[model samples]
Target: MLFIDPENTPDFKRSLFNAIVAPRPIGWISTMGPEGSVNLAPFSHFNLVSTAPPVVIFSCNAPADRHEKDSITNVRATGEFVTNLVTWELREPMNISSLDAPYGIDEFELAGLDKAPSRKVRPPRVACSPASMECKLLRIVQIEPQRPGDTVSNVVFGLVVGIHLDPAFVDPDGRFDVARTMPLTRLGGNQYASVGPLVDLARPSPRHD
Candidate 1:
């Protein structure tokens, strides 16, 4: 087995860190800037952290020079954003929105994506996504810079205020058929994967329960 200190490791292997943390859900985040400009970007480090209050978190990397990414900047400014679920059919547009463009450039128009007005937020949602969550900014936690010229991590937590789901992906039982949605996820460098065949695994219980 090979072992190397992550912080002091060579630059060549830094990307391996993401590759090691395989199959992360893509947070197709959309936010409106202070000037009403729209921005869209994808983050691989995203996940749902709670069920009761419906908390979701995604992290953005801020370079030492270019600190505070556009998403973070917009979220801080507007306190509202939308997380759109990426589907197999919408993958190209999703990737298109990830383009790094000049500030104030509208990604929706750049990517040729139709926008749907969110119920409780100023930011718009991608019309072609299988589902979307309108979120209110809860808080942003900025981690200390690891080293000189290194990127700082801006961890943003959002509370789900509204949700929209395409009826086609819903099951008769009133639940989302996630597999049918063909959700796309990141898998290390230059790789992506889609939801596979469904598997049902019941949780084991103790006799006392």
Candidate 2:
């Protein structure tokens, strides 16, 4: 077994960090700047943190230059953003939006995608997304820089204020058909995977004394 310390490994991020995490959900976040500019970006460091009052978080790691990403910058400025689910059908457009464009560039137009107005947020949802969550800013936490010139992680937490689900993906039992959505997930080194056959496992019965 190889024992490696990240702090001592200069190339750990590129060599092992993301690979070890395996497949992670992509948070296709959309936000509107204070001046009304729109921004869209994909973050692998995103996940649902709470179920009650639904809270989600996305972390943005700043470059060595310490430049804040547009997604976090816009969320801080407007206090509103949307998380659009990226399915296999919408993967290309999602990847296009991930381009490191200029601050004021509209990713929707850049990707040739239409935006649907969100009910509880200023930022719009991707028209073609299978689902979306309109969120209100809860807080922003800045992780301390690990070392001089090291990148900082800005974590943004939000409360899901509203959810939009495509009726076509809803089951007769009122469940959102996640398996049918075929959501895309990020792997290491520019790789991605799509949701496949799911395994159902039931919890074990409680023991009786």
Candidate 3:
């Protein structure tokens, strides 16, 4: 295997590395403005940052002219957002919300998605999503963008306040069964994959070496 240090390679090295880390989870974030405008978008640069406090992170890239996107703006205004898990069945509608729509346009209507009222937040949850996380904004930390004069970027960190999961996806003991959930993942540009197969490794028991 060839080892590459990003700084020593072409400018696209970092981007290539990220892409090679295939099948990253998507964060379908939904947020509402004070005027009740709703925004929805899928972010690939997302992951669970902490489990102890139930913290998650999703990167929000500013527009080309260098300003916060509607989703980021809405979250900043309301200080709350819902993260919906994209499933293979909902991929089509999920793609619709990924468009660059004008502000105040309801993505739910544009994407023809059903909105279920959130129990703890203003932004509603996608009815078709396998799972949804209601979160309160903890911080929006700015980061350097890939290109000079490109959009400003920041990873929004949130504390999960409530979790909504479909009963069918949960096991008898209340564990989320990935096999049944059928969650969708981002695989670079214009590509996606589903969760498949299972591999279990038992932890080592205490023994004298």
Candidate 4:
């Protein structure tokens, strides 16, 4: 096996580290800008951070030149945002919204996607999404860079104040089915993957003896 140290590797090898992490969930975060402009962006470094209060986190990188991404700026200003789950059907629009559009540009309109009112957040949800989580900002933590010249990243944590699910996608068991949801996920690089075959893994019996 070949060994590589991330700190000393070339930029291409560093990117491979992200790809080797396998498929990650895409965070289709939406927020309302200071002037009420709708903003949307996709982040691969996102996941559910806690379940007790249904908290989610998405990390935004501040480039060497730019102040911050639109999604990060909007969320900080409004203290509320929406997480729209990207599905196979909405993949194209999701990709379009990821464009580095200028500030105050409405990605929703840019992508030709309809918006749905969110119950607990200032930002709206993607109308075609199978599910959405309305979140209130909990905190924004600046992650210390590992290296001297590393780019800055802010990890925004939010509590899920509400959730919206498309009734059509609900199963008889009251559970959301992955197959029906057709959720899209980020693979390394520019590749994406959709829900595939399911495998059930049951828990082992308790050792009471």
Candidate 5:
């Protein structure tokens, strides 16, 4: 086995970290700019952070120019956003929305996707998404730049205010059918993946003294 240190590695070599982490869920986030222009983007560095109050986080890495991504900018300005689930069927549109378009450009229009009204947020959700979460900004945590010119990362935490679920994907037992939904996920580089065969495991029961 080869050993490597991230801090000592070259800029290009550091990208291997993403691949080592394996597949990650895509956060199909949508936000409205101050002037109401919609911005849609996909972030692989996203996941649920809590369940009691329902919190999620997505990290936005600064572009090469060290500028904040439009998704983060809009979230900062409006304090609201929506996270739409990316399914196998929506993969193309989800990838299209990742384009680094100029400010004020509506990615929904660019991707030719219809917008569904969010119940608790100004930003809209993808009309065809099997599920979506309307969220209000909880806070933003910034990852300090490691080197002088290194880009920073902004982790946006949100409190889930509303959730929408398509009836077709929800099981009669009241659980979201993960296999049926076929959520899209990101792999290394330009690769993507979809849900596959699942393994079921039961947690060990508590031990008695």
Candidate 6:
């Protein structure tokens, strides 16, 4: 196996490493205000940060102009948001929300998605999603916060307050099976993938004869 230090690599080389971490799950985050203003966006730099207290995180990278993304801003404003699972059926609509648009324009309307009121959050959840998590802002850590002219980078963390799941996608054992959900994951560039074939194995006993 080839081993190399990440710091020694060039910027593009590091970026290449990120891209090669294939088929990352997309975070279809939605946030809104008490006044009804809303924003929806996708970020591949997202995953479950923990499960004990039900925490999740998604990084809102610094924009080209060194500004934080609207998702992070709105979550900070309202202290609540929802993360909808991106499935194969909703890939096109999900992509639509990724475009840069005016802050107040509801991406749900733009994507022609139906909104369902969240049980524990102000931000309405996407009705068509297989699953969605309502979250409260735990913290927003500004990674390498800007000094005078330095570019800003930030990572937002949340504690999941509630979860909504479709009955159709639930397994007999009460688990959210990815195969049944047909979830889509993000790949490098303009690529995305659906859930692939899965295999299972049994663990061996620790006793040595």
**lDDT assessment of candidate 6:** 0.85
lDDT of 5 by residue, 63-115 (tens): 97537998999999999999999999999999899998999999999999999
Candidate 2 positional error at 53, Å: 1.9
Q: Rank the candidates by TM-score, best first.
A: 5, 2, 4, 1, 3, 6
Task: Give the residue spans of candidate 6 off by over 4 A.
Answer: 1-14, 145-151, 203-205
**RMSD score of candidate 1 (Å):** 1.7
Per-residue lDDT of candidate 4, residues 50-125 (tens digit): 8997999999679655877878888899899999999988899999999998889989999999999988678999
Q: Write the per-residue lDDT of candidate 2 for residues 1-209, one digit (tens) a residue.
A: 99987678766664367878978999999999999999999998999999997999999778644379989889998899999999988888889999988789999999999999999789999999989999999999999888654677899999999999999999999899987889999888889999766899999999999
RMSD of each: 1.7, 1.4, 2.2, 1.4, 1.4, 2.8
What Cα-based lDDT does every candidate model obtain?
0.88, 0.90, 0.86, 0.87, 0.91, 0.85
Per-residue lDDT of candidate 1, residues 1-209 (tens digit): 98787667665466787898988899999999988899998899999999898999999777444667888989999999999998877788888888878779988998999999999999999888889999999999988866654667889999999999999988899899888888899987889999876778999887883
The candidate 6 region of ten consecutive residues with least summed lDDT is 6-15
lDDT-better candidate, 1 vs 3: 1
- Model 1 TM-score, 2 decimals: 0.94
TM-score for each model: 0.94, 0.95, 0.90, 0.94, 0.95, 0.88
Model 3 stretches astray by more than 4 angstroms: 1-15, 145-150
**Could you tell me the lDDT of residue 163 within candidate 5?**
93
Best by the TM-score measure: 5
How far residue 31's Cα lies from its native spot in candidate 1, in Å, is: 0.5
Residues 1-209, model 6: lDDT tens digits: 97776545444253564578887888999999667798888888889989999999998666774267888778888889899999999999999999888668899999999999999889988899989999999988887843443356678889999999898878899998778778889877788989877888889779987
Model 4 lDDT on a 0 to 1 scale: 0.87
Give the C-alpha miss distance for residue 163 in model 5, angstroms.
Answer: 0.3
